[model samples]
Target: MREQASYLRIADDLRRRIAGQKWASGEQLPSRAALAREFGVSGAIIRRAQEALITDGVLEGRAGSGTYVAEQRKRCRMVRFQATGQAGAGYRGPDLGVLGEGETWEGRSDVMTPAPAEIAARLGVDEGAYCVRTAYEHLVDDKPVYLTTSWEPYDVTKGSLVVLPDGGPLAGAGVVRRMAELGISVTRTQERSEPGTTNAEEANLLGVQRGTPCTRIERTFYSDDGRAVETADIIVPSVLCEIVYELPVSRS
Candidate 1:
């Protein structure tokens, strides 16, 4: 059998040390040169080993500071909407926290003069169609936890009282109630979730490292008559939040 690479072997040794509590959480690790000398390896090999640990979330690097063991992340559980749950059945605008405490949400809305093609497709409208877009940041104690962008076709909302999702009389009212005011009953929702890596923009928005694991959810709401009314894309940092889906089962 081919032997494992030197850097990988060193990384495995470090992992065992960490698991054995030789280094406590949030404790700083030895410098690369120091570790290299102790391990009888080149500095480059030590650096690679450390990088592996960083990617595993066992270590974190701070600018101008040495590497340190990462602290256990505080995880928030987010409960998804159930078809039978009254609290989450409709478009309540930006209700972020389902079971987490000390969480707050802020939203900003704008009218997209020309909506993007993908968003237009989700809303069942033509490209360049006017749409109302809202961006939201969910935070825990002022730290970003997740981000989302919601789009609604302007054709369904123009000249209506619910033009702005977070404005006018229906401000903060979820999509279902606002649409009901316009005689549109939202009866169904569809959601798709996938894993992804954070890009620079998302990393900055969520205050996480670039390339961190994340969850992306695409959601759409449909009216009773099968008209798509609204769509949203939500990005969540994996380390900070856990997405939980509570599915309902029917018995015959």
Candidate 2:
């Protein structure tokens, strides 16, 4: 509707263009001033549209340069691992819940980034080494619900489908899922969840005001021999997920 907010209108128009393939991967987008005139809105409104595209991974803007269309791919999908109750089947096929579309899993090159001291200690790896990092962000109805970063030894993950260069269903499926397939079944799961404030990137993606309160869920998965295989930092907006627990009481 014309009465809609200017930012929303600009975003809607750009969405249509991207969906229609008007811009291809690596294609440059019009300058802000140009877009403003096209939409009959101010540059501020144009900036809003660009921000939305960047968050959605449809476009990437380079500082001092121009914006370019990002490669199109299935960025996000439903990954449901049932913890208990009727949902206890585990993260199988899609259709777990409405994890509104976007990059559910993002694969990056096999580059080494120095792990935080805590992460290095947990993984038992040197601070600097070839590590394959895969990042994942999940959304429910187009808003960020979960964010995770996973690291695997380069020798273990190289030549594997860790990074979706061609952009297909997220390989690794998730560390646990892939590990189980490779005969490395997880025997124990440790989780430490607490409340915290959302960071700048998460705040923008989740559509929450910056520094909004959020829940931080840290999980470390181990094999039977006490080998730590994977570590994940899961940032979850409480509004989208609820944690329920069941405790058995001792009989008197």
Point out where model 2 deviates above 4 Å: 1-90, 93-111, 159-172, 245-252
- What TM-score, over all chains together, does every model reach? 0.69, 0.54
* lDDT of each residue in 1-252, candidate 2, tens digit only: 443477877787887898888987778998999998987888877887788777665677778998888654332333334331123343331112334334243334335656667777767777765555556656544545566666655554455553322133444345555555556766776778799978888866655445666678777778777777767677766555554444457698
Off by over 4 Å in 1: 1-72, 88-97
Q: Model 1 over residues 87-176: C-alpha lDDT tens digits?
A: 444434464336355666777889755788998888788999998999888777777788988888888888988888888898867677
Which ten-residue region of model 2 has the weakest summed lDDT?
A: 92-101
Q: Name the TM-score of candidate 1.
A: 0.69
Per-model CA lDDT versus the true structure: 0.80, 0.61
